[model samples]
Target: MPHITPCLWFDDQAEEAAQFYVSIFEDARIGAVSHYAEAGQDIHGKPPGSVMTVSFELAGQPFLALNGGPAFRFNQAVSFQVVCESQQEIDTYWEKLSAGGDDAAQQCGWLKDRFGLSWQVVPAELSDLLGGPEPARAQRVMAALLLMKKLDLDALRQAHAGG
Candidate 1:
């Protein structure tokens, strides 16, 4: 089967971003690093032999990071969702991803990483708790979730249970 990979554009940090992502996810690894050749230095305006792209995988998902210059940037319009099984998982991702990011951007489990990449570190049970059979309980969970920056699984569970 064919696969489609999401390509991320960065100013000059494709390799750094790829390495950082690999360190965060257990099943991730840096696959390849390609450098710019002398031919396109005029049009691309990049130094010859500089990093051009990086191939990597995060938790089994393939991604490509390109040192495509500052023509584009990452914004909240796009985000990667990390479905966490436990609160510890959420905490880990939240702390690491938000380390050098904009603190004002954190809300409802959504955060922007140092690279300006947006991420959603949410509890795996979040969907079930907010879309379960009980409408009132789910509503409560939604309300609780809206008030949090980093999701609190325990608080969500209590809200789901009408506590």
Candidate 2:
């Protein structure tokens, strides 16, 4: 199968955004960085040597950050979901990604990062808690989930257990 990579558009912050993401994820790294050329100056409006694209990887998933200007902006329509195994993992990601983010945009384990990118930091066992034969348990867990910003695995488990 052909490998697919997510391309992120930034307003002259491709390199900066890639660096920030690399710093947050343990298995992340910045790869090739391409600069603009004088040929496209009229259309791109960027300096000849300015950064144009930054290739990066987060949690082994390849991504490309493009300095495509401010014509477009990130919204909640697209989001990256981080499945964490523990509350500690969730807390770390939530803290890092939500830093300098809009507080009003945070709800139900979803947050907008400093770069305006939306992220969903959820527990690994979320499916199990919200699924299964017991509809009441799942409903309770869903109710609990709807009330929080960053997800609490313990609270979800408690709700699933009818506590």
Candidate 3:
């Protein structure tokens, strides 16, 4: 068992979320579904045997989702990032993730989901250059990222080298 795991707090629909996630990613599976007991209080108007927690794996990382009432919610402050090697991959993720035409950021990322979860779709090289040691180079890359909805490494490099 992983000593540490990220647990997601959903208003309800924990099982539905788990199923949705597992269906989207390869190498993913739903591990467990804990349903509310007959003696437990009805939550979300669900039946006593309805799921209260769902455990699943995404890209091989274990995550837990709880039907923990409305105590917490997802926001842009914490987002999952998908790094792509080419524009094709970027488009694929963007299309699937932003299905409902949710809000998009100018820097080549968008937030959308069947469940309203936010995601950042970035080019792999952008993370490489932005995290590189050269400050000037990194700044140039950042500038390039600012103008694009998806990162373009060639343009960023050209700008960095002042070409």
Candidate 4:
């Protein structure tokens, strides 16, 4: 099978960003490091043989970071969805990764990380509710989801009750 992974280009904080991402998600780990060889890139502020690339995983998703120039940045076009089970988990992740960025509820359990990386912190119960046989109940749940950020299950149920 062919192997493929996302390669991220960072101005100079590839390693730091990798560490931050790994710390935020479960099942995350740094695999290896690649450094520049002979040609020194003083322009990028790193020595000739310095670390330039980092291989890391977030939520079992493999990602590579390259210490390239500031030619690209993280945008809302791509985001990560963190399916959470409890409010405690949502609070923890929200408090941790929401640092240095605007944490606003975007309906249906979605928030933007400090780096402007969008994330959806949804409850596991959402799957159960959405999978229910009753179409009206599911519609109610959907309507409720449109007004939430962290996906409060209790509130969603109440919304289903027309409350």
Task: Say which candidate scores most in lDDT.
Answer: 2
User: Which pairs in model 3 have colliding backbones?
Assistant: 108-149, 108-150
Model 4 is weakest, by summed lDDT over 10 consecutive residues, at 101-110
Mind giving the per-residue lDDT tens digits that candidate 2 earns over 1-163? 9999999999988998999999999999999999999996999999999999999999989999999999999999999999999999999999999999888999999999989999999999999999999999999999999999999999999999999
Model 3 worst lDDT run, 10 consecutive residues: 101-110
lDDT of 3 by residue, 65-139 (tens): 888877687776777887777877877777766665455443456555666576788777766677766788878
**How many backbone clashes does every candidate have?**
0, 0, 2, 1
Q: Write out the backbone clash pairs for model 2.
A: none
CA shift at 34, candidate 1, in angstroms?
0.5
User: Cα miss at 67, model 1 (Å)?
Assistant: 0.3
Error of 2 at 61 (Å): 0.3
Superposed model 1: Cα runs more than 4 Å off: none
lDDT of each: 0.95, 0.96, 0.73, 0.75
lDDT of 4 by residue, 1-163 (tens): 8667988777778888889989877789998999876665645666677679999998778999898866787776776777777878877876676677665535456666665567777776777777666788778888878877666768876766657
Candidate 1 structure quality by residue, lDDT tens digits, 1-163: 9998999999999999999999999999999899999997889999999999999999889999999999999999999999999999999999998999999999999999999999999999888999967899999999999999999999999999999
Model 3 segments beyond 4 Å from truth? 42-46, 104-110, 152-163
All-Cα superposition RMSD per candidate: 0.7, 0.7, 2.8, 3.0
Clashing pairs in 1: none
